[model samples]
Target chain A: MVFTTTKFELLTNKVAASFGLPDARIVTVDHPLGGTDRATIERWADAAVDTVVALLTSG
Target chain B: MADKGELLEIVDASPEAVMDYFDDRGWGDGLPLVPPTVERVEAMLAACGGADPDEVLSVLPPRFGECTRRMVAINAVLAGCRPDVMPVLVTAARALGHPELNLRGVNATTHPVAPLLIVHGDIATSAGYNSGLGAFGPGNRANATTGRAVRFLLLHVAGARPGPGDASTQGQPAKYSYCVAENTAASPWESYPRSVGVDAPSAITLHCGENPHNFHDMEADHPGPILEKAASVMATLGVNNAPIGQGEYFVGLGPEHAATIASHNWTRRDVQSYLYERARLPAGLYRKQFGSLAWFPWMHEVPDDHLMPATGHPDHFKIFVVGGAGKHSCVVPSWGMTKSVTLAVAP
Candidate 1:
């Protein structure tokens, strides 16, 4: 399983496949995390917490 | 090409058709390429001696493509490399796979880092490689094509494209081709390979770094002012070398610059030591900006007022003379996670 952003989605998939995890569980957030304010990042993280938990909990 | 690995032969193997075909499939390096002909590939392979064509050198990351000797020949041909440079190309392939070089990080990082190939010893002149004026610039066929061949290898074998595979935000031009030779003829000291204790007839060094940052000192009769200018370039926080522990700095001195430095009876070690002492900012400034750093043990133990070296060790400041008669030099800063590897040119 992996947590990544939208920009790295394709690269994550490519990396996953190379490491023999073609179907690795990958959760995507927004495109960028750098140069953003803490409040915005925290809000995004808060909104995505439930989905992340569900994905982790799912088989 | 059927998949990423298999380069299938197209029926229309003409020059224009081949270009369009590869361009359409995201295989071209955004430049005109010499079509990989069977005869040309055969010639390139023949220069590699009795090595197995199908032998898998190493599995490159990001795409994990199995790089074979035959594929090396194919890419070399496509890069317009002369058959005489086959052995060097083969060595370059093997060096890229070295664990210490960290090919995986270099391919995936967003630093605009490119694998800089430094050719040394007899190979520079033997194969018509450039080690003189405009060494880092264009016009020399051997230097240009050989460097282009390595980029082609990364593209075809390692599967490193700009966006998907190579995650560089704004990749620099060095990503296209960055190869130069040590100006042994004009250098004051021994050849770079010999100075580094490599006794080989010819060797190649692969360093993943940003483009050269030019520094010039035309009026300096001594080495102090010259090296001080270079130190100023290395001390800035913008470069990766400023914060990282093992980030290497390759200070490329021109002929006249090296002569000026050598006239004061300074050895390579002396130059390194001088740069290590001079290329520093106060430790307190670094601590104020960077929350955490990949610093060497000594950096952490130092006082707040202590001048912290950009790269912790003196040895990390790699000094070698390149370029022709000029008072200019350049600093090639490493990506910090990768290490340079030097290997002999053999099949």
Candidate 2:
């Protein structure tokens, strides 16, 4: 599974396809990942945790 | 010779209409483009001296588009490049695909880094490249269009469009066109390629770095004060090289500055040594700011207040003379993970 931000959602999709991973599992979060506060990042991580776990467990 | 991609058919419209069509499709670089007719592309490809037009030279990133001789020539025509400049662009495309360059990360990172092409040897003159006063700036056709052709490959083939594929925070002017030729005759040292042990009659070095940051000192008769100032510029907290120990810095010394430094009987290695020893900051400062410090083992073992050099070694300071008669010099900071590649232009 791949973790990315919305700003890179399209690029992730394109790059994944190019590498022959057309069905690569990707979990996308909101934009502006680097410049945010710790609490905000933690919140984003918490929100995306469920999707990451599901991708890890299922086909 | 076969074309690489599918042929597009458009109406025989006015020049303005054609420009509009290209702009709508994201082909225009906010500047007017020369209509790349099939004849012009064929003429540009003919300059390659029998290289197969359909041969895939490089597989560019983001889109993984196959870059063939035909596509490069087509983009060259669109950039208004003369047939003589084809060899430089072809060599640069190969350099872009080199693993050392890390072009994928260069395009993906939010840092405003662009590839700066330095043309060398007979081709620099035969192709009419500007290496004299204001070389990095505009005013020369061969330099301008050849540089633009490289960018067009990123745009058309690699699909590194500004918003999506490039992802730069605040894209710089160098992203449009960044190229210059070494003023080898004006310099005190040998040609840059030869200095680096690439003994080709003609070559090109593609370094992915921020735009040139000019530093000028008019009254310095000796190399000490002038070089010390350059070290101070490198030690700044804002530059990406501070935390990344392996980062490379290309210091372009103006001819007058090079002459002054040479008067001290300083070789290129001497300048590199001086800059490496001086371009430093307190290790504590780096630790306080960034969460992770990507340094060498010795750098990591140093005490908090110990002064650490900007990069790992003196060899990281790649020195060469550029520009015309002036006391001005410039430093180009790398994007940290990428390495510059120098290759001979194909005959």
Candidate 3:
């Protein structure tokens, strides 16, 4: 969760490393949520993570 | 009396004194701000994984000052975001600094638009973001804090302190913080990320916007005429982005409305094409009010009567479906000058 004004990739990589996850483990996706609402976005995020975790575990 | 705890003192002092302190220090929002303190700032920093407080995220234009992470923490703390939510704020700050996001030009524009935060993926859920009813209002921590922190950072860090350089005729409510999550459960079409070709997992997108104009069509069960209505509103003149040429537009379709479109086997692009084709305001509507509306210099030879002159490239209309299962839709016009840009949210 470290935020760098510069070097975003490196920062995300650091997080993956801390989690004992490979760089490939880090997934990056564009947000589908509209900017005008919050609950909808949160739900989508929750679903996205669930889907990702399920895929990871199934593999 | 050398330094009798400024935080405690400000809390105990008069509102006038507090405003004076912030104004004197150029920390107020041209209005006023709740005084920020060490305890509050630390709490806010904790939201974003407790990163070092001194990291610089942006050097905003107009004032062109370094928006250090610590300063951002202070503002976020004051804005009342949970510490973990700070990463979202940081990602947003990072996005604003992107050359394409063009916060400098946005801040300077006379348009009544503000940066709108569109959150996606796991972070939105982890932070308890609101994507349901009243999702845009103050009760939601993720929405309130993430958006407000950006506003506070913009003012305190980047220095868009109004009356100095940010001269909007009527600044929007979003100036305080305008962030929301999408309701994917309700959307039948591919989520925004999928439409844009990203498959990773989560991200944050941005749209420079004025207020949203809702389309209430509970009477219509079908998606076509409802979409037509939405598009007509989108193409109307004197609205935020319509006065100018194309850039990007946001269509926030609620669940029932989204289902209608999805049931029709319409992909998000299909819906976008429908809207784009219909976004034609009369040529007469533009010439009188927006004198600057004309063909690009390269098209000087083309006749002026061309319908729907190209305001930007074809990718101008950006669309996504979210919100509860309600009979409603919304169209948020672009700021008419800036384009919507998406930045991946850092974990």
C-alpha lDDT of all candidate models, in order: 0.87, 0.89, 0.68
Candidates in order, TM-scores: namely: 0.96, 0.96, 0.75
* Tens-digit lDDT string for candidate 1 (B1-347): 21223446889968788889889989868888887767878899899787888787777877888777788888888888898888888888899999999999999988889999999888778898888889999999888988998998888878898766898889888888889988888888877777667779899989899999999998999999999999999998988766788999989999999999999999999999999999999999898888778998888999989998898789888888889877789999999998888887887
Docking class of 1: medium
Best by the DockQ measure: 1
Comparison by lDDT, 2 against 3, better one: 2
DockQ: the better of candidates 1 and 2: 1
| Sliding window of 10 residues with minimal summed lDDT for model 2 chain B | B1-10
Sorted on TM-score, highest at the top, how do the candidates line up?
A: 2, 1, 3
State the weakest 10-residue window (summed lDDT) of model 3 chain A: A1-10
Can you tell me the CAPRI class of model 3? incorrect
- Could you tell me the TM-score of chain B in model 1? 0.96
What clash pairs does model 2 have? none
Residue-level lDDT of model 2, residues B1-347, one tens digit each, is 43366677769567788789899888858787888888888999899999888887788897777888888998998898999999999999899999989989998888999999999998999999998899998899999999999999999988899766888889999999999999888878888898888998899999999989888899999999989988887888887777898999999899999999999899888999999999999999999988777788889999988988989999899888789977899999999989999999993
Model 1: per-residue Cα lDDT at residue B183:
88
For every candidate, give the share of true A-B contacts it also has: 0.62, 0.52, 0.00
lDDT of 3 by residue, B1-347 (tens): 11112344564457688778767776645554555677777676666565655667766765665665666667776676677776777777777888877787787665777888888777778888877676666688788778877777777666565655565667888887888887766667666766676654667778888877788887776778888888777777767565565557888887778887778787777877777677675555566566465344543344446456324444676677666657877888887767676766662
Interface RMSD of 2: 1.6
